[model samples]
Target: MSMQLNRQLPMPADLKAQHPLSPAVLERKAQRDREIREVFEGKSDKFIVIIGPCSADNQEALLEYVHRLAEINEAVKDRLLLIPRVYTNKPRTTGQGYKGMLHQPSPDKAPDLLEGIIAIRRMHIRVIEGTGLTAADEMLYPENRSYLDDVLSYEAVGARSVENQQHRLTASGMDIPVGMKNPTSGDLSVMLNSIQAAQSSHNFLYRGWDATTGGNPLAHAILRGGVDKYGTCVPNYHYEDLMRLLELYGERDLLNPAVIVDVNHSNSDKKYKEQIRITSEVLHSRSHSRELHKLVKGVMIESYLEEGCQPIEGERTYGKSITDPCLGWADTRSLIFSIAERA
Candidate 1:
């Protein structure tokens, strides 16, 4: 054999029992879930903001960010629904570098999967208990999602993983709203196909058991733009792009026809500062087309306590990002209110 097995880890159920959530926390999470669902279901017109750091590398800093989100959620409750991102796993284009907190719970230390699992769970529980915010996470690994299912209110299949079969099938099995981004190639058709798969029940092998999903009707689209053959970033958050999405949704029998503009990534070309301008343009686009306004449910923004990204080595800035650069707390706060004003 080419590989040796490590110690078997505890099941997600057992781990939950070990660090169980309080009734109050569970209830709070349920409420957040429902509010987010209403946006995708068309029962509510309030805009949704799935905003946070690109990778949650530390518990204290992540909690600090979530608590701030809670305060803002209170102010914009009438016009916007806020869901903070506590993503623990990050996708690397070439299969190298820091995987995430799930791989290295302590960034300065070496990777330890066992401790990493417990650390991530505790961090998520802490976020819910302290801030009353059930954050969103990227489903980078389908098998690992069980560890977070109870605490996460939302999930997004990243642009790189949108076409994977396991990702689509697992998303179908999930009950919470899952946003599937258009592939890096900019193929909207592939994205639509993935969504169709996620919204349709399928019998498949999962976690050593035969499982069938009831179809996640809330699975929708996240247009994060894409890269062309020449390796140029092609943005799709414009008025024309949104109208095209509206037309695309019309051709499908998909439920709750909706889309979320990911203001970072290719959409902003990873220029964190562009998030503000992109968001303004998207809100302006909504102002012009009623169809565009109705179809776009929210925006996904990458922001942290400090603005921009930094290297892992050397003296770390207290709240700067270790992964992708993010809008600082000041800019993030201002952007939320601006979105509320326009919404």
Candidate 2:
């Protein structure tokens, strides 16, 4: 006997049909994007700090957190260019778990994707307006770009997607500075290829229209450690490794040769407390080696209102990460201050 299949289907309506950006928002985003590009080009020496929740599950909590960050920005205005990571979506390795607030705001509930998109956009806009600080986010889905392209200042292609042709093509057309992270296996070559692809002109299909890209000159690299079965961080951001990578890029003649060191991830072996040590060590190495120092542009840290992380299955904890363990506020503050002093 043949069995019938039961499958749920997505609605045909466009996600942005309900909510669209006003011209004012687009202008604001354009100005912010220019400033970000300036910083990436070394025209502005401000140390870019992209900080926020590991996954923004609650809009209210994220808004409150950015308000505090804005205050910190005022205090460190001379030294840092603050960009809150209002990351609404996440990519899983084996494609399991909660994904992010966009997929499942409530752990036990079915995905309200339409509502999720609106919630994320609202939260992002609020952060930009409320804190008066620029925002950064990972571009996970190309289709979702239209909804957010007007509000974000900086864009990132995460480790899992850096080598993807679709992501590289998308980055090529982005007006904002794009940071391409090294692969999860700690391969710098993949990042270099991704960066090169993003910095070159390309023609691809986009939105039912033929599109040609002007190419992004502000595309760069991000060094986040690698994970293996034994659980050790490889390709540690040491002076030699960084120097070699930079030299390779120079040889390849890539437009942007700078890199951002991700202080959390494998670099810290996922130990939130160790992020401080790793950051200090990298800075010290850079200080002694002029070559590496020139190649090192900034740093990225995973931080939130609270420290560490809690599982989504049990009772949820406040301000903690649902995906990865992040450095708590206290540790984050101390690290930022220390790094600023070093700068």
Candidate 3:
């Protein structure tokens, strides 16, 4: 006997429509975009801090965290451009893990992608409107870009996807500056190629439509450290390493001249405390290389109201990361002050 297969079909009521960007949010995002551009161009020396939970799983926790961050942002407004990481989607190496708020908001629950998209947009809009601070996020899926294009001030292409043609094409047309992270294996060439791709005009199918992009001149690189067979985190933003990258890219006229250093991830081997120390060292080391100092525009940090992380598939813990561990609020505040003093 043959068995019949059954598949559930989505109902019209179950589909969520894409939300519209409010005029107020658009105006604010425009101002934030200008500020970010100024910093990238050397017109402003403000240190850009992209801080938030590794996975924004809990809306309440994230909102409370951003409220606190807003207060700190005001304190360092003159020297830092604080952009909260309202990241909604996450990429996994082996295709397993929490994913993020947009994928599996409730552990073990089936995905409601339509609702997930709307939820993230609503969250992003609320964060910006409430905190009065700009925001940043990694663009993981090209299809999701439309949901966020109007609200984000800054964007990043993660290490794993930076080498993909689709992501590069997406960056080329981005209104906001985009940072391409170094490859997972710690290869700088991948980032270089990514920057090159993002800087060139491209013709590709985008969002189910034929599209043409003018290319983005503000596309830049990020150093997020690399892993070796010895199980050691190798810092790639050292003065010598940065100088070499700059020099090489300069020779090819492909250098962005503006780079952001990620203090977490492999840079600190996922040790949240080390992120602060490494950030300090990078800032201190900058004084020795004039060219590199001028090129090192900002830093990226993973921080939240609490330190460390909890399993996503288990009982949820408030204020803790559902993905990678992040610096706690106290340490994050201290690091911001230290960065300001040094700057």
Candidate 4:
């Protein structure tokens, strides 16, 4: 075999037993799960902001950041439903550096899957127990979803994974909202198809067993923009883009049709600061056309306590991002208010 034999880690049940969630955390999670579902199901008018660091590199900073979010949620409670991104597993385009807190809880340390699993589970538990918020995470490893499944309010099938059969099948069974993003090559059909697959029943192998999933009605699209053949970034968050997506959605037989415009990624071209501008434009688009206003459910923003990013080695500015660049705390708060006003 090409791979070395790694030791088997403890299952999620045993791990959760060791670090149990308090009744308070469980109550909070149920509340958050319902509210978020209502938005995707078109039952709630509140806008959602799935905002946070691109990668949760440090726990203290992340905890502090969520605490600040709790404060912001107070003022924008009427207009916003916040789902902080505690994205622990980051999908690397080339299988390279800083996979996430799930692979290396400490950036400087080597990969230890067992410790990483415990660390990630603990972090999610803390976020919910400490802040009364059910966080969001990427379904990078389908089998690994078991660890955080109980705590996550939302899960994203990233641009790269949206087309994979396993991701589509797993999403089919999830009760929570799952956002599937357009691929890097700028293919909307692939994303749409993934959503379709997720919204229908499936029989597939999962974690060494035959599993059946009843379609997830909340499965939907997330436009993060895309990269062209020439390697130039192309944004798909304009008024025209929303209209186009709506038309395409109309042509399909889907349920709970909705979209979430990602302010960062290819839309902002990783400029980091452009998140604010892109957000303003998307909200404006949502406002002008009632059709768009109903179809556009929310927006995703990459943000943290500190602005921008730094090298993973020796660079430890508290809340700054170690993966993709993020909008700093000051700008993040202002942008959230602006989005809420328009939402």
Candidate 5:
């Protein structure tokens, strides 16, 4: 066996006990959860903007970003809900590079899984305590969901993991909103199938027990675009693309048939600055048709305090992304108000 056994890590329950959330923080998280779920359930019409750094690598910087977002959230509480993307885990296309805060709590440090888990939880709690908003995180490792279950209000299954059965099953058990992204190959059917699985009851072996999930009706679609066979980026946030998704949803019996367009990734070909234009276009599409207005519930944006990204090795800049390039805070703030105006 080539795999070396690491020290046994503490269970999520034990860790939660060791460093728990305050009562006020718990109440705020619960309220945020309900509001987000209401949007998926069609009970609320407010738009969702899942925005934040691509990978939350620095705790201090991340909290500062969230605090700024909180001020904006207060100003736009009537029209929009801004949920930060405190993505502690990241998916690597080549299985190399920084895997996220879950692998290395500090970008410049080595892998320390135990400390990473604790650090992620603490960072998430701080976001809530300081900003009163629970964030979204990628469900990269389905087994690690419990570590963040209580603190995260939203979960996303990345394009790479969307078709995995374990991800589907784990999503089924989640009580909050879960966004399933189209596969890297841009297969809509694969994403729809994963959504179907997540919206159905399942009994599976999770951790050490036979876990049963009653199905997650809030499971929805997230269009982050995809790569073509020729390695070209294919965007799907256009009016025609959204219409196609609406037609696809019409053919299915899935619940809460909503879509959230990811403004970055292949949609803008990772051009961080393009997020502003992409978001405007998506909102325009939503305005042109009533069907789209209801079907397209929100958007996912990669934004941070500083615009763009930096190399992991040398002289890291504060508040900038260490992973995917992202929109800067100034553009991000303007974009949020723009979305609120049009959404």
Candidate 6:
């Protein structure tokens, strides 16, 4: 074999025990989970904002960012539900570069999976305990979900992973809301099929044993736009796009027929500053039609302390993203208030 086995890492159980969440944190997470679920289940009319850094590289900077969000949450709590993105596992298109805090606790340091696991859990715990807000993370590696399952209130299946069988099966089992993004190829059918799989019961191989899941009714759609055959960014967050998605959902017998428009990614063509305009446009689209207003749950924005991203190899700026560029604090706060007013 060409690959050498690295030292065995602790299982999720061991890691959980080592860096356990206090009862207060657990309680807060439970409450936040229920509230977020209510939004997807149509029990609540409040819109959700899954906003934060694209990749949480530094715990200090991330916590600082979340703290700021906490203040904004207070201002928008009546109209919006803020679920900050503590996305630790980033999906790399080329399977290289900074993979997030789950691979390297420190961006400049080497990869240490064991330490990375502990660090991520601890950071999550601190976020809940300090801010009383649970977070959202990307379920990049299906098997790794259990490590943070107890603390995470929301999970997203990236556009790249939405078509994977394991991702679909794992999403089916989650108790929290799992947002399934349109695949990079821009196929709505494929995305809906994945949502169907996730919203149905499944018995499959997970970890080292056979596991059965009773399905997740909170599974829903997230449109992050897509790449065309010739590499152009094709956006699908317009009024027409929402109508099309609503029509598609009408054909399916799925449970929580809702969608969250991701304003960044291909929707903005990775132009970070365009997030503000794209988000406003989605809200404008929602306001024009009652069907769209009901179908569109909320929007996702990648925002951090600083406005843009920096190279990972150099001396990085604190709070600036090392992965995807994100909206800075000032703009993010203003946008949240604007969304709350419109919502």
What would you estimate as the lDDT of candidate 2? 0.79
> Model 5, range 1-343, lDDT digits (tens) per residue?
9999989999889999998989999899889999998988889999999999999889999999999999999999999989999999888888999999999998788899999999999899888888888999999999998988999999999999999999999999999999999998988999999999999999999999999999999999999999999999999999999999999998999998999999999999999899899999999999999999999999999999999999988898899888899988898889999889889
Worst 10 residues of 6 by lDDT: 21-30
For each candidate, what is the lDDT?
A: 0.93, 0.79, 0.83, 0.92, 0.93, 0.93
| Clash pairs detected, candidate 6 | none
Residue 163, model 3: lDDT of 86
Clashes of 3: 0
For residues 1-343, what per-residue lDDT tens digits would candidate 6 score against the true structure?
Answer: 8998899988899888988888888788889988988998889999999999999999999999999999989988999999999999999999989998889998878999988888899999999988998999999999998999999999999999999999999999999999999999889999999999999999999999899999999999999999999999999998899999999999999998999999999999999999999999999998899888888999999999999899988687889998899999999989999999998
Residue pairs with clashing backbones, model 4: none
Cα lDDT of model 3 by residue, 1-343, tens digit: 5975444433322332335556786788788889989888778878787888887888889999999999988889898888898889999889987677787665468776755776787888889889887788889997677767777888899988998899999999987889999987898888988998998899999866799998898899889998878878787867777787777678666535688999899888898888888888778777677887788888899998889987766576689887899988898888888888886
Q: How far is candidate 2 from the true structure (C-alpha RMSD, Å)?
A: 3.1
lDDT of candidate 2 over 168-274, digit per residue (tens): 99899988888999988888889999999999999998766689998999899998878776766785577777777877887787885788888777787777777
Give the residue spans of candidate 2 off by over 4 A. Answer: 1-28, 228-231
**Looking at candidate 3, what is the lDDT of residue 340?**
82
Native-referenced Cα lDDT, model 3: 0.83
TM-score versus the correct structure, for each prediction: 0.98, 0.90, 0.92, 0.99, 0.99, 0.99
lDDT of 2 at 206: 77
C-alpha root-mean-square deviation, each candidate: 0.9, 3.1, 3.5, 0.8, 0.8, 0.8
Worst 10 residues of 3 by lDDT: 9-18
Clashes found in each candidate (C-alpha, N, C closer than 3 A): 0, 1, 0, 0, 0, 0
Candidate 5 deviant stretches above 4 angstroms: none
Candidate 5 has an lDDT of 0.93
Q: Give lDDT tens digits, candidate 4, residues 173-262.
A: 999999999999879999999999999999999988899999999999999999998999999999999999999999999999999999
Error of 5 at 289 (Å): 0.8
The TM-score of predicted model 4 comes to 0.99
Worst 10 residues of 1 by lDDT: 286-295
